[model samples]
Target chain A: SQTIHQWPATLVQPVGSPLSLECTVEGTSNPNLYWYRQAAGRGLQLLFYSIGIDQISSEVPQNLSASRPQDRQFILSSKKLLLSDSGFYLCAWGPSGGNYEQYFGPGTRLTVT
Target chain B: AQSVTQLDSHVSVSEGTPVLLRCNYSSSYSPSLFWYVQHPNKGLQLLLKYTSAATLVKGINGFEAEFKKSETSFHLTKPSAHMSDAAEYFCVVSVGGPYNTDKLIFGTGTRLQVFP
Candidate 1:
């Protein structure tokens, strides 16, 4: 059984602070990874996705960036956080090929004050 | 370009009543549709998916969704609503060519509120 993990479960940061969120998957290899942000009342926005190591795609132009350092390890980072960057961050993984139904991690809730 | 629309931003239902969350999608190809549920401050969970097979799909926790190509809709439903079912639901569409990295387009989401 495959599982996705993310941390820290919750974080509170001041504006202009750096941000780093980690996601890792077990029981799968070469899976596609994705980062999404969900704002209150607003729908989820896809921030980035990676097909493989060093192959990252940004869906929205924002302060956040994503990287796939290892096959199953993905990281979301930002040099400086904005007030608008506060939201629930989600990490998801899908099979490399086929239907592409994604599985999500527990998620990280960031509050930029 | 592919997109999804959740017909309702919020839906309130009494416990034991039937639940319906409507969704519509637009896609150039035979799209793959999915319904995901998210509890408060939690990550989204897969409720069901329609991938070119089984118009009627059953999901966890007594949830189900029907895919109607003519209507371009994939609405989720349950016979009886439970308090635990109160959450936000998102309709998703997969966009990509035959050999490309598929991107999922998500709807704004419909928040389900189950009241006793």
Candidate 2:
């Protein structure tokens, strides 16, 4: 069975600080990875998605960026965090060229103070 | 362009009662629809998906949804609601195809509260 994992389950950072969140998938190769943010009492907003290594797409223009260093490793980074960046970050993976259904990781809750 | 709308921002129901979460969508092409549930402080879970196959889709936790093309709606339903059913539900629509990187448009989400 395939599983998605995310680190720093909870994070607290001061404003203007650098941020990094990691996501890795096991038992699957060449999977589609996505980054999403969910604000309090709101739905999810797609930030970035990668179909393969070094192929990343940004959905929204913001303070965040994404990279796919390895086949199953994806990272979301921010050079400087903003107060608006405080939210729950979710990582998801889907089978390449398969059904569009996605599986999500435990998620990272970031609080930018 | 693809978009999804979850009608109710919050719904309250008693345990053992039926559950109905309404969702409507708009898509220029053949759309793939999905329903995801999120417990508090947890990641989203795929409850079910409709990919141009059957109109009636059954998902985990004895939940099901019917796709009404004419209405452009995919509403999730459960015969009996449990306390565990209290969570936020999101309706999503995928734009593009399998060969390309499809984007998922999510609804604002509906918070379901089940009381025993």
Candidate 3:
């Protein structure tokens, strides 16, 4: 079975601090990766998605960026965090040939003070 | 372009009663629609999906959704509501063309509250 892992399950950062959230998938190769954010009581907001190494599509302009440095590794980063950036961050992936239903990781809850 | 609209922002139901959450979509092509559930502070869990095949799709935890293309609606339903079913439900759509780029667009979400 395929599974996604995300790190720093919870993080408390000061405004203007750098942010980095990591995600890795196992049991699948060349799967699509995505980064999403959900504000309090809000829906999922797609930030970025990567089909392959070095190939990424930005969904919305935000304080976050994503990269696929390895086949199974995807990273979400920010040079400087804003208070509004504090939210639940989710990492997900979908099979290349399936119905394209995304499977998500445990997620990271960020609180910027 | 593909978009989803969850008709209800919040719904309250008594436990063991039926559950219904409404959704609609706008797509240029035959769509791939989905419903995802999120517990408080948790990542989303895929409830069900409609990919132009079956209008009635059954999901885990006794949840189901009906896809009505003419009405552009994909409404989720459950025979019996459980407390664990209380969560935020998101209606989603992915563009179907080659340029569609499987990026899923989410709805505003409907908060389901099951009361005993």
Candidate 4:
């Protein structure tokens, strides 16, 4: 069975500070990785998706960016965070190709104060 | 392009009553649809998916959804609501094909409230 892990389950960052959130999947190789954000009382917004190492497609223009440094490792980063950046960030992975059913990680609650 | 619409932003049902969360979709082609659930402070869990294989799909936790192409709807239902079923439900549609860049378009979401 495959498992996804995300860390710093909760984070508190000052506005204008940098941000970094990591996600990794075990027991799967070359999987499609995605980054999504959900504001309080709202639905998820897709931020970035990576098909392979170094191949990332961003769904929105914002203060955040994503990278696939390794086949199973994905990182969401920001040079400077904004108050609007505060939200619950979710990381997900799916089988290669057009499989839309994805496995999601526990998520990171980022509070930018 | 593919999109989904969750009819109700919030629904309240009494325990032991039937549950219905309506969803409608729009797609240029035959698209895949899915329903996901998220408990408070928890990650989203896949409840069910419609891949054209089955018009009626059964998912975990006694949940089921039926796909109606004519109505362009995929509505979720359960015979009886449980307290544990109170959560946020999302309807999603796939926009890509096997040869395209795959991504999902999500509905605003419906919050299910099961009350005893």
Q: Model 4: per-residue lDDT, tens digit, B56-116?
A: 9999999999999999999999999999999999999977733345688889999999999
User: Each model's RMSD to truth, in Å?
Assistant: 1.4, 1.3, 1.6, 1.3
lDDT of 3 by residue, B1-111 (tens): 689989999999999999999998998888899999988877889988888788899999999999888999999999899989988899998763232347788999999
Individual DockQ of the candidates?
A: 0.65, 0.71, 0.60, 0.70
Which candidate's lDDT is highest?
2
Clashing pairs in 4: none
- When candidate 1 is compared with the true two-chain complex, its DockQ is 0.65
Ranked by DockQ from best down, the candidates are 2, 4, 1, 3
Q: Which one wins by lDDT: 3 or 4?
A: 4
Q: Compare the candidates by DockQ and give the number of the best one.
A: 2
Count backbone clashes in candidate 2: 0
What are the TM-scores, per candidate, against the unseen true structure? 0.96, 0.97, 0.94, 0.97
Residue A109 error for model 1, in Å? Answer: 0.8
Kindly give the stretch of ten consecutive residues in candidate 2 chain A with the minimal lDDT sum: A94-103
In model 1, the runs with Cα more than 4 Å from the true position are B97-99
Clash pairs detected, candidate 1: none
Please give, as one word, the docking class of candidate 3: medium
Docking class of 4: medium
- Where does model 2 exceed 4 Å of error? B97-99
User: Residue-wise lDDT of candidate 4 within A1-113, one digit each (tens)?
Assistant: 99999998999999999999999999998899989999999889889888899989888889898989899999999999999999999999999976768889999999999
Q: How do the candidates score on chain B by TM-score?
A: 0.95, 0.96, 0.93, 0.95
